[model samples]
Target chain A: MSEHTTLSDLEAAIDNTFATDAQQASVDVVEPGIVTAVETLSMQQALNRALAEVLEENPKALVLGEDVGLLGGVFRITDGLQKQFGEDRVFDTPLAESGILGMSVGLAMAGYHPIPEVQFDGFAYPAINQIVCQVGRMNYRSRGTMPMPITLRVPSFGGIRAPEHHGESLESLFAHVPGLKVVSPSSPNEAYHLLKHAATRPDPVIFMEPKSRYWQKGPVDTSADGYSPEGSRIVREGKHLTLVAWGAMVARCLQVAELAAEDGIDVEVLDLRWLKPIDAEGLAASVAKTRRAVVVHEAPLTSGLGAEVAALITERCFGTLRAPVERVTGFDVPYPSGDLEDEYVPNIDRILFGIQRVLENRRG
Target chain B: MAEISFPLPDLGEGLIEATVLEWLVAEGEQVERNHPLVEVETTKSAVELPSPQAGKVVKIYGGPGDTIKVGDPLIVFEVPDDTAGIVGTVPKEEAPRRRVRLTAALDDED
Candidate 1:
């Protein structure tokens, strides 16, 4: 009786410093194996885990690529696939990039959910003909009467110290193509769910696996509970600036966000999973709060998707912008040698520099 | 004579075409199972394709620098009909494999 009477007093004594669930709801799981619950894996391992789970859940899901079946891929993302799924289901393809994409187009037309690997970003150039003209446009051309439920996987971005054209961030090229949905997961968790989502999408999707972040591990809910590619994830909410990025750049932006935190700069981070139909509304809202923004990517600064994002932000939130949008991106020159990739790829300091520029503009 | 045709296998990371860099065996040359048949370079890396069935090479479909797609006829071997003891010896499945399509129910839309 005494304790019951003292309950209100104890409640009143509580600090109430910790935030409650009222702030944000728990994560919603779309599919059972959509996310990894425990130990995080490298981006590559995360993709492999997701593919294994997806193939297990859906017998129709097939993985086709060069060296992916037996050699486990040059990056080893598809290691042991041939043995587990048998040579028939997870075998290697010919060296023709266009043939791979064209065959995938036909496979999707024939009702196959094909996930074809382009091997590398530079190599993906050859497949662009098939992807841009046929694979990307087939479904729209048929006006939904036909769907190319194919996922074109390419490991893109610089910073892995790859030689020559191996590390080019050619996202702009894919983004320019209609009927193709481009996406990149910046971390292991996003990689797991995004790949699953890409595999399941009805239209052809260009899944650019960030080869640079292939080995970085993070939290993943492998229990299959995760978000969809259609949604833009808010990594951090800020009242000062909105930092929008994807794939490897997202990770760099997050680091910059951490640095900004040290300087009392509250910056919101937006991870755009689906690059084609981006979460424009959500991004505008973030910019409206911050009144400033910085768009970043590994692709060249000239016509990268960041340019499109900058345009969209200004169009949607013109009055809200405290300053013009800034972009931190790769240079226009060809991807340099492995030794010079560090300078080519945008990093924490570069992103921070962008934030500083935007903040200064806001002050001015 | 039993005909052993080597239809190109999926090289894994979804390669569709490969360039034949070198032929390890000449037409009419005898080869053993798992012997390196040809060196093919795809988009990612260069690899040596192994002979599935041990026999005499009757024909080579792709020459050096010639590009070929998966499921294309790689080689035609005059395999002996004496024994079908080869484990991985798959009869030429098809000239070009029909696309392996995933059913609609399994198609996961975003």
Candidate 2:
């Protein structure tokens, strides 16, 4: 900083930094294979443990959000963290998503890793300015000198019969932004590891926590390696068709896959965990094997993340695909409140019907 | 120059209150941080509570079997103005007896 500098010189330096970065390998993920000693944990407990570990493992990391400290979040995803990590490392913040995220940007620029929560998916709207203009752009905007090591948590998606704005899906919006890595973990196991992995990366990660799945219990292998930032995960193996999904929809797809099996229909379920950087290769591979695909998401169908996945599938698996990629998504309308949510969210029967559509539309 | 109050912190496992089992340090006795100040029995088990900072004990509230709430003042102390009985002390002409913000800064780990 003391050296004399010009705009051209800074641009040259920035170009050099990016060149090195492009050649640099992506984040190294430990492949903890066959972890057997796992504890049964709800998605909430797993997320809590992940944050606790982040604070404990990195002295530079902290957690901030509304009711995150004493109340432990509306979903209690951060329960007992304040006591375990102390108020300094884990504390509540004012009920302003923009302020919380703005503080995170400042803190990250100051060399602190901050995990700020938006409380609910809809709550992120107020913070869109900070998220898009600052958090996602700081690194590139600063010529790679000011990478934001932030994990912005958003308790997302539908199903617990909550009111409007409480059950919104914003994955499409987050993934569309440049420089933001969007990830949504569909289960307790994925939630535990993906969160830990997201917190460690030197970029901002939009961590979409499926709210309805928070209380569902599943085995979490702590010692297991976290999911790689590279691609989607194949949760079930089948040869007939692949059900591409993430978040709460993954569970619903799995159930539909089971039901599809009884009707002499074998299906594969692929959880597209990482929304941005869409894991095009993995999607192509899964669809290449199955030859048919149906994407399921909670967002509206018009320009939802499912459309992007469908396009990626078409681009890479066109010849191998026996049918065009189909999407079973929410209708193009505002996410309604409870009492109408059951019809709004894609259910098992709707997904099965979508699967049947793909099965019927044979591309000879 | 300052009277510092010590509230019973929530011990792990979500215990809200603890009954005084015994007093290990008498009033007016000087004790260092982490020194056993009193023994208390919770619903789970009996455990000794430690002095949070180095100070002269000015008063000890409650007797044996008396219950103390999680945030209730359990003891008070008298400490020098400069030597504030709390973490993250700053030099001030009139320093209030309060714990400073917890931080993870390299030299200021708390």
Candidate 3:
């Protein structure tokens, strides 16, 4: 039998044997229809609503992951989805990461949009082969004849003290890869809209969720057109230095900017929501105005996504820069134990240090 | 009533110690099966440990900022013999029921 046939048979056997009626009944069904009013929701809840909205509007979209069906995902982001959508659309799969990505590619090839959750940042390693080789290359390899619409959900970043492999800032790996679009949201409002955009886009998107900010709440305007993933947002505007960050670090940068303001230094904070197709122009513009720049992230310093942003700012705003771009990031080591994690991960002090370095280097 | 001690569980691989972040249930308070008893910050993540069975919070082992190792006593609960199977034995049906209720609550908010 063909490899696809074998996988299909295996999936069929697992579904037939394990997916019971009681499991379906056990999952609660949320009332249909999207919430239109402005409401405060945690990042997790906002992402959940975004997933539900996508599944509601697009019949071709389906969610599949381990514990996604009956358990509603480990983070409960997929809660109430299986019951509303049914087994075929929102079903659980065996604990095989490679199979998950491979099957998603096949599903996309068959004209279906599949949003598969990796469950955690570390678990994604097993499926890296499929993600980098197949999913990222399919559309270009097909000479534009094939369109792959797949959103891989990854819960990432530290600060929650999650054990090994659970808290990682691995977006840099995917961002370096050519065909995938990497997007991370720092707030609930951004999570809702960016998720909607990622789901609807006709390309593969690695949606990294900053797990530390999962419970961080903010107002989400459901009626507004969710911002496009093509550009960056100037969340806080200032004149002395540009603070560029995304995911969980955005909040940290804002806090750093607030602290800088008390010292009479106005810092402009830019959130690079889209990683792969980074907003080079917008970032350059921000740096040009501020004349100094600092990039912050929880990932390590060497070749981290922050390095790429720093390089881009250098390339675009070289003539206008008063100081070299500085990066604030985790050390170049494996994420340490919980006791040492606070020191390992970049905090407000480290970010402020970066800001201070750029300011000290500023041309008088 | 018999008092049972619940130890801090290993949240994930190689987690040695965790900080007691907050007490979800205070001492002398009644808690139902599966109700969250305490929130602890481990190396992996911040997790709320649920009460294993219906009981009264007889004593909490640590205060906020106290570091607790895996297998260290976390909470002490007093429970009647009939309801206490073990320190943390939650009813099988209660898990799904809680999920359903959470979904219902979110739906109401929507």
Candidate 4:
């Protein structure tokens, strides 16, 4: 294939994988079969289906953001939602992130579960004041009398060659703020369930989507099962090292675990689905078993979400750890251009290096 | 040589069918494992299906623009007995690796 053809072909393959997964996911939700019948779906499609389901079940739920109405969002996460739910329920607002969020807070105050989409992670900076100050603190401010049911969706993380400010992994920033539940789903199954859970909650939630994994496909059981997004889960069981990650990095960790297996090292993978109010107990249990831990993320290392996770692990599993916790993360620099993104983002080699560092420090 | 019928694999979650956009390889053409075989588009994105093993394309299933279901056979590959494990048996590791951007700026190696 020509260079141009190859590039586009690669892009197409990624897109096709997500699309096919979404199609399969629809089957599970709509088809009448055994409750265990699972369907594959891309992360993006799963989120879309979750939004559709939320609007369908909850009449008070409203979805609004720039292009969410006619354009169906930049990534089309809200595609056909307006048509299904009408212009009032799924509509667009001014291109102001702060305004969108501020309005969501007001709507929530009026008893509406407002699910607003902040077009991109970088663009969310404009609305950080509202998110951090009002949306996050409203329930606490009211002394439990009032609850803010706003699920702000921000498509985040690097990779996919997006422009500056488009691929920011700002989950750490939100998780630092008090009273906000921060969630980052890694797969279609988690994305589908976690989004629904976020919408149903009485508190404000920052639903960070790893934009890079929008097209990543996986199996999803849409059988009205009880899957809570409240805590972390050990996705893969191993005894050598514990890999803690969320969003896109979970897949990377799983891949690293596979590579580590080649070297006879058993790696347990933990998906920290909920960033804020992290499952400290679950994380501690996994670390206690493995005795070595490595935190991974697409965000920059300094004060990233990984730092909080590492601190938690160190504090809880201090006596059990065999070595110092290592972190595999993006460099502490502005997200690089598309051409140099691979260099900026963590990959298999970097994660392996982290595992190796922990192993080298293992107590004899 | 045994014939392996390569069906359209699940492209992503919930995808039941896809439309053939283009054929990268032709019937009677030789292909190696992981070679691009066809381009298919679903509702989400365009994807290129790769060959599972080294073989000669014995038959092509659907023409461009034809919609094929998940289990529909897309290609028939004639391969040696040892290579005939299953069609669309591309290893998970063969999938595209995420390029790790060099962190020279972060390193102290001047």
Per-prediction TM-score: 0.69, 0.71, 0.72, 0.70
lDDT measured at residue A239 in model 2 versus the true structure, 0 to 100: 82
Candidate 2 lDDT by residue in tens digits, A5-66:
78888776555322233422243343435445689997878998888877877878899999
- For model 3, the superposed segments whose C-alpha errors exceed 4 Å read A1-35, A362-364, B1-110
lDDT of 1: 0.75
| lDDT, residue A51, candidate 2 | 89
Query: For model 1, how does the per-residue alpha-carbon lDDT over B1-110 read when each residue is reduced to its tens digit?
Result: 44556777878678898999999999989999899999999888899988886788999987899999998899988854323222111112122222212121111110
Q: Write the per-residue lDDT of candidate 1 for residues A228-308, one digit (tens) a residue.
A: 556688888877789999887776777677667667677799988778767888888888877889998878888888899
Model 4 residue A353 lDDT score: 75
The model with the greater DockQ, 2 or 3, is: 3
Q: How does residue A103 of candidate 4 score in lDDT?
A: 96
**Could you give the candidate ranking by lDDT, starting with the highest?**
2, 4, 3, 1
Order of candidates by TM-score, top first? 3, 2, 4, 1
TM (chain A) per model: 0.87, 0.90, 0.89, 0.89
Docking category of candidate 1: incorrect
Q: Which candidate do you rate higher for DockQ, 1 or 2?
A: 1
For candidate 3, give the docking quality class from DockQ.
Answer: incorrect
DockQ per candidate, 2 decimals: 0.02, 0.01, 0.03, 0.03
Comparing 3 and 4 on TM-score, the stronger one: 3
Higher DockQ: candidate 2 or 4?
A: 4
